[model samples]
Target: MRTLKQALLALLVLSSAVADLPTEMPIPEAFIGSPVGTASL
Candidate 1:
């Protein structure tokens, strides 16, 4: 159980690190050409 908790914590940390990186990393240029839909909820 302790090891599982530690693994979950490690995963959470890694996900946060990835999300903190620049949002401008290369992506399909066409993705930007089409407007993103808005959320209604």
Candidate 2:
């Protein structure tokens, strides 16, 4: 149980760290051409 908790904590920290990194992937032209608020929920 303790190991499971530790693993979850580590995963959470790593996920947050990765989320903070800048996205290197290119944005599709369709997404760029789409007007703002067109896809908003």
Candidate 3:
């Protein structure tokens, strides 16, 4: 019914909106480096 159609429409809109987001998020500088004595994996 009507509710199912509305749910599908809402999902379509949400998915489209999410698809427009940036594919590559920038990494924060703090996580990119470690202190002089510490080892990074």
The residue pairs found clashing in candidate 3 are: none
Highest-scoring model, TM-score: 2
Largest lDDT belongs to which candidate?
2
- In angstroms, give how far residue 15 of model 3 lies from its true place: 0.4
lDDT string for model 1 (1-41, tens) is: 99688667655654565466567753333234323211111
lDDT of 2 by residue, 1-41 (tens): 99688667655655565566457733343234333212321
Q: Whole-model lDDT for model 2 versus the true structure?
A: 0.48
Per-candidate clashes, comma-separated? 0, 0, 0
lDDT of 1: 0.46
TM-scores for the candidates: 0.50, 0.53, 0.50
lDDT of 3 by residue, 1-41 (tens): 99688667655654565466455733223223323112232
Give the CA lDDT, 0 to 100, for residue 2 in model 2.
Answer: 91
Better of 2 and 3 by TM-score: 2
> Per-residue lDDT for 11 in model 2?
56
If candidate 3 were superposed on the true structure by all CA atoms, what would the RMSD be? 15.5
